[model samples]
Target: MSTFHPFPRLPIELRLRIWSLTAFPRMIHVKRQCVGDHGEFGLQYMATSTPCPPVVQVCQESRRYAPYRRAFTTGAEPRYIWVNFESDMICNDGSHDLLNLEPHQQDIQRLRLPIDDELAYDYITIHGDQEFKKFTNIKEIHIAVDLQFAGFSIEFLAATVNKCFNGFDNKVKFLDVGSGYMMDANQLRILSDWKNYYSFDTHGRANVDTFEGAIRFMRILDNILTLSEMHAIDDENAKIKQDQQFL
Candidate 1:
């Protein structure tokens, strides 16, 4: 009776609830740093606490709460794995991260691919396909691509996607495609063709021909573009203010 343990005295359900809250999932942006001295790549900025979770640091009885462990085990939110395919020799090596996932982490369900013009296809053919084959539990794939930069023919992209998802039959679910660059009539038609071929559930689809659904996509795009412009303007104004302060 020497110790004062108010938290332990609480009901078991309340204690579990408190532990789960401490391990809430946050949006994490992953970037690959250069090859290390051992020539092995390393991840730089994954959004997780430096040490362990506070609850885990508690006594053994608190550690027995499995939900606390499961929640904090994954760096990214469950059901959404993000990969940046932009060609930046400095900070864009997400392809490498996807390739090197541990066996337990390989069973990802949803993927968000953000690709630029250069090296998109090359990266997909080599690294992406390899990862996809390993992702036997993959369910949905979301893409935001710059087709204009790579000058990728519609046929080429379709073939690449098919190849990447070759191993999984119905396990591969919806394809949510959006574009950073403007798409022409022909390009839109190509997406339509792919949708028809896959016959995916459009309830989870975006930027597709379904007029009602497309409206939702357009609204989201508009908000993103607007926010981007606002941020740029804010940065410019801040710079000017700083310069004036110096004067």
Candidate 2:
């Protein structure tokens, strides 16, 4: 008798389930990358426990079940993806046109947008809307505003919100202000007005003034984002089950 490898004989559905079970945690960091002077663009994710999981690289069958680089790559429509902006000019200039992400990427259900100051926010406002309108399935936008930047302007909040809803016809489910500087009375009023006007859910630190406050605020935001991703995944799984039953 010959010893056999039973894993390979498993059904594709089971294989995928196993792969998903072994998947690196869903909450992941993503960033933009450019290659060559011609400016070929690509998405890069922060290193994970197994950046290229053995499942993906092991064999053709298992590879099909592996989540490829696109899963969390910049333009890939991953389930839950986080992008943190610490600088106004770190990646692409706001003047740069939004990259043409795949339709699924545009349909990301959960997103953690960057936290930037006035200039960076302005850049996004000027150049990011066109790309944002493509996000048809966006359910939530978690914004992390960096309070350390003293140049934050009130206009950033309204402009960002408007851009997100511009052509999507209010498809977004929530506009969460996850972290930012402690708002003055006026800013708080504006935030209140927007929440009412947009009729969307929000969660975040209302006040973050000191250095210690900023650090603590970030930890809280991270936890919230993680929970959001978990909820989204559970919702998706439920939906999938429903669809399967319908079929």
lDDT of 2 by residue, 189-225 (tens): 3444543443233554335433334335445544223
TM-score, model 1 to reference? 0.44
**TM-score against truth, every candidate:** 0.44, 0.46
lDDT of each: 0.46, 0.45
Tens-place lDDT per residue, model 1, 143-169, is 445444535544455566566655543
lDDT of 2 at 211: 34
Error of 1 at 112 (Å): 2.5
Q: How accurate locally is residue 240 in candidate 2, as Cα lDDT from 0 to 100?
A: 98
